[model samples]
Target: MAQEGKLDLLLKTVEENKKRRVEAKERARVDFVGLKVVVEGRLPQVEKKVSDLGKVLGVLSTKVEQLESTVSRQARAELLPEDIREEHLDASPSLSTPLIRGSV
Candidate 1:
């Protein structure tokens, strides 16, 4: 009868919906697995690049520290009395002649 037909149509619709949901879930799983594989393949390269960057950063840090130390020493020397500055310059092998006072 009419009720039986309605029941059958409803059951058919429910089955179709269930099938669609299952297919969608399977597609999502496949996509996730593909993404996982790609990421796994590239992870090592990413890690290596990060490590290289860290090494570069370390070298840069050391250079900066050395430069800072040199600057600090120069600043301290500049703050000394003119006589002391001349003495230091005379003692340095690099400066064979003392700098004239008040001369650039």
Candidate 2:
């Protein structure tokens, strides 16, 4: 059609989209407030559960770290030569590929 008609259609579409967006945003805001209220009501319980989980995780992490260290010590004592024990300990992630190749 004419340029003015096309512009008018575009303006109408933009306004309709703006209205829909505003409505969607308001609905989302209401849902968020309701969700916040629900979460807030359960705050103490959630905090307690989170705290317990943290304690369990902390204990697990400590045990894992201790196990790793023990395994590392035993491996060094058994498999590694004495001269390279310290060097190997320091070399574990110290080496890198000399070349960087991208897609062949």
Candidate 3:
């Protein structure tokens, strides 16, 4: 009778564990679905923002190149005599133009 009782208790525990496992699996599946839905819903907006950022990066890159070029020209001009510097500046009007803050 004791052995039978032990067997019954073991069976009951096994069944409870199985039930818990199934419940856990169902919860995980539901959570995954909810996460998928959320990600899918935001994916387009995220992509668009990324694209916009890429455009801004491209613009910023162009401005950096322009600034680098202007700095290079100014450096070269400083190495030259005043008369040549004036002539060089005259040849490239942009080199002499004062940069307004935030204009780029």
Candidate 4:
């Protein structure tokens, strides 16, 4: 009789453990589904943010290109006058006397 009672108690304990395990699995599944839903809901917002940032970067790149072009034109303009003056001087040979040979 004692052995039969012990066997019944062991079976009960086993059953309780199985029930707890099943409950734990169900809770984990529910939590995982909730997490997935939350992440899915936020995905579009994240994508929009990324897209906005890309647009901002593109605008900045265009601005930089424009600035570089302006700078390039300004630099050429600054140096061009000097080059023209030198050319003009070279073209006018009669303005300066030519150096004679063997005369320092």
User: Which candidate leads the pack in TM-score?
Assistant: 3
Give the lDDT ranking, best first: 1, 4, 3, 2
List candidate 2 segments past 4 Å from native. Answer: 48-104
Error of 1 at 37 (Å): 0.8
lDDT, model 3: 0.92
Candidate models: Cα lDDT each: 0.92, 0.90, 0.92, 0.92
Can you write out model 1's per-residue Cα lDDT over 6-98, one digit (the tens) per residue? 999999999999999999999999999999999999999999999999999999999999999999999887775987879888887883335
TM-score of each: 0.73, 0.44, 0.75, 0.56
- Clashing pairs in model 4, backbone N/Cα/C closer than 3 A: none
lDDT of 2 by residue, 1-104 (tens): 69999999999999999999999999999999999999999999989999999999999999999999999998777765765877877878854454544333
Candidate 4 lDDT by residue in tens digits, 1-104: 99999999999999999999999999999999999999999999999999999999999999999999999988778877779789788888664444544445
Residues 1-104 of candidate 3 have per-residue lDDT tens digits of 99999999999999999999999999999999999999999999999999999999999999999999999999877775877878877887574334554354
Candidate 3 wrongly placed segments (more than 4 Å): 81-104
lDDT of 2: 0.90
Summing lDDT over every window of 10 consecutive residues in candidate 2, give the lowest-scoring window.
Answer: 95-104
- Candidate 3: worst 10 consecutive residues by lDDT? 95-104
Q: Assess the local accuracy of residue 103 in candidate 2 as a C-alpha lDDT between 0 and 100.
A: 33
